[model samples]
Target chain A: MSRKPIHRLPAWALRTNGAVVLLFLYAPIILLVIFSFSASRIPGQWGGFTAEWYATLFDDSRLQRTIAVSVRVALVSTLLATVLGTMSALALERFKFRGRRVFDALLYLPIIIPDVTMAVMMLMFFSQSFSLLESLFGIGLSKGFATIVVSHVAFNIAFVSVVVRARIAGMDATLEQAASDLYASRWQAFRFVTLPLIAPGVLGGALLAVTLSLDDVVVTQFVAGPGSTTLPVYVFSLIRKGVTPTINAVSVIMLVASLILVAGSVGLQRANASRGRQQLRTSGGNS
Target chain B: MAEAKRERTERRRGFLLALPSFAYMVLFFAIPLIIVLVYSFATRTSTGSTSLSDWNFDAYRKLGEPIVRNVVVRSVILALVTTVICLVVAYPFAWFCAHQRQTVRNVLLVAVMIPFWTNFLVRNYAWRILLSEGGPISSFTEAIGLGETDILFTKLAVVIGLVYAYLPFMILPLYASIDRLDRRLVEAGRDLYGSGPQTFRRVVLPLTMPGIIAGSILVFVPSMGAYVTPELLGGGKETLLGSYIVTQFLTARNWPVGASLSFVLMAVMLVSTVVYFRSGGKNL
Candidate 1:
């Protein structure tokens, strides 16, 4: 933090620039929250403060259904992604194998590719597979909840694996080795020693996966079939039809919920980090 | 013999553990990419359906037509501008964030992410309201004697949308690199009689090069594929690559052409990613 002063750029100028950027990011958000409570039917202009928009939102069954669908997809996909990703992370981190680089690249591919491309590709693949199945056995897979979940899990796994892998790599391996030395089996070594150490990473990764699945729009739009619209996609449709204050209410609620989650996730990580440091200090005290 | 057998068992177990993820990727990621490649070379039937039977270079050849070319060029130019603007705006802010006290730094980082945590579509919708005619911004401009001009349905509005959406992507990465800056190097460069600017140019800039490239790539790639911002802010009047590609599938029903354009976009992304990594992108 003690870098030499950047004399060419004065401190006041730098501070102002930072302030503007922060304002640029937050002003619209605050405005949206304010207008969400407005009694006006117009989108942005404030007429009178009221909670009528929130009341209207409760009566909108379509929005409610979409929200339910989104929550279900988020939770299920996160759970699946967490389990699969944690396994992959442990395998990659704990054991060296041939084709490790190729495997790593394949996993990272989902992250780097743009969502539009992935969306199109997944759509094509799914439709083609459906065609093949129907041709052979006259069975069809409707692209609804399953399609959304599958597409989400495909990317979420990669994301969760990356987070969990970082956690696993940073963990002390000697604890597990010492467990084995104490006559514990390999499974017991993993369960008792490694699992507790990596729980924070797992939880963090799950939080990320759930939020990402909830926030996704582009990929879900392509994969979602009849009656499969998620909340964000539904919001996009509302925007298309000229946004109202009710939609603003929706956005405000969504934003507030995620802010809470964000706060919780960051707090959890900070707590875990301090605990991990303390554990290291105590465990290494003898040495 | 026992040790060898144990090693074999461990390897077997490890592979078993990784099987689910590997299988999922093979089914979803790898196969879909292959499908895009195959469809890109397939034929577009007269009814606008992609026929798998006939294979030709028609789609690739069609990519150079004036309309598609215009959209492609426009997208590239807009993405480049957005990247540059993000870099200029984010660098000073990131530098400032890095220099702040630890608690303040964390608070600033959290604030940046708070907007990001909100739904992207909702946030972009906010920009639409902000930049619309007779909105606060328009009223402010009029009060300041700049005149009330329509800005929402124009390229400038689209640029505003792109920058707002991707600015955080740029800031977070840049802050990470700047915060981890090695002070000893700056002091060393100064001790060697390098002036402040020289030391900054030589030491600080090079140290944060990774962040610059990463932030640039993060902002640039997504902005290149931008769909919603332009559609919402630009009023869908102008065709960028994103809307153009979506149009092929939805409105035009030309799957082969859409698939081909997708491949080209994917190729550009892959090449740039590899170039970035090859050029010493370690933190990635």
Candidate 2:
């Protein structure tokens, strides 16, 4: 462009600051990964690179069980959240209804609320609800896999809906109208036209839900009963008990898992954005 | 009459489509929050059970207790300091990113967010490792003849962890505002012979005020109610609001007091979030 403005920052200064901040962000994680392979049991001492910690993880049955629980919970919760969130997104995007504003605000609550507070709320709610059920119908329950799934869906629904709603907002409503005008039933219109258009968003939301459910610790800690500890919760306890070589391995595994998922998510959204741009370019002034 | 009937059916169908999610949120989220508020007034017995009968303001009054006040003040101060540091660091970085070409900006933004997507607990654990005795930083200091620095389990470590954790929150919003800024105004200010600082102060700062407010709230709200950072880094020697509230419920078994503190924290977050939304911070 024209000669750089007087107020523009020097390139070297910007690069240095960016490098420092990035290093601050990444060094700890990179170090943790490196130490995970250390032959020494002591965390700070890097004896030699070995795969013993990774081997140790496989031998630990406790870790295996927790991973199983986390997977089951994440799968079930992500499914439920995707369905509920998609339905809510469709309702908000396609309709003009009374109390819509209220519905919108309520949907955002679970997201904006803090994690610890949400954990406490769910704890209190389950306890009180279980007691009430016992007193009234002799049915008793406690926090476990079911409660964890429920808590996860509560938050995931908001996140999923936000993602799906973005997709729905970008869509051409007239396509659905066209389908209906062609004598397609409402269900048929949604199934054929709307669903295919928003599939990427639905999948993206599900990916996010599963990741969140898997990574959750604070909320799960409060709601999980004995025998129901998820992997992250178990890892959290291990860290609290003090660092060990095994925790390093576990942390590295977790880091890699999330890294892959995030890369997938970013890739999916990028592809979707480019496709939207292509559509716009092909159908100029359609909006 | 037919038109009216058709509109009515559409409304009914719309409500029906959303019914399951609406019911779930009300039952699990809204009602539970109401229950938390109710529990705040319930009586806590000496035996540590919360009784519904004979509700009182004892729990609310305990909010004024010296111990509670200290924890609240500490949480506020720590949160405030974290927000300020995050802003100071993130603003320049965000500016740098916004000034970059599109491909570079996108790459930089994604790099910033990679930590955010990774496990939260694990990130804090990474810090625990870094700041611990004989950790890499300490070893480096020792190598430089500065002696081993014992920074772990201290409040300073807690602050560092907090800033590290929430820096992305500040940067993203600031970048959004900066990228959306009209460059012509800056040029106009310069053409009027305004100094660089004056152009920034008069035009840039005011235009990006929304981002500042949004980023501050995003960072501050979570920092105030932080549980994991303090638990991992603060060494439990000093109780912050989040850990203190957990203690009342899990350890102390004083539900009323815990519920009250939770309610107050929720109220503060809700207010700040409302301000954030009003300032057009819907990008989240």
Pairs that collide in candidate 2 are: none
DockQ of each: 0.70, 0.70
Candidate 1 local lDDT, residue A137: 98
Against the correct fold, how does model 2 do in TM-score? 0.97
Candidate 1: regions farther than 4 A off? A1-4, A280-287
- Chain A TM-score by candidate, in order: 0.95, 0.94
Q: Give model 1's TM-score versus the native structure.
A: 0.96
The 10-residue segment of model 1 chain A with minimum total lDDT is A1-10
Error of 2 at B282 (Å): 4.7
**DockQ, Cα level, model 1:** 0.70
- The TM-scores of all predictions, comma-separated, are 0.96, 0.97
Candidate 1 local lDDT, B104-210, one digit each (tens): 98889988887766678878888888776677687778889999868987898989999999999999989998888887888888889899999989899988988
lDDT by residue (A1-287, candidate 2, tens digit) is: 55455456777877888999999999999999988888987886689999888998999999999999998999999999999999999989888677788899899888778888898999999999999999999997877999999999999999999999999998888999999999999889999999999999999999889888887888898899898999999988888888998898989998998898899889997999799889888889675
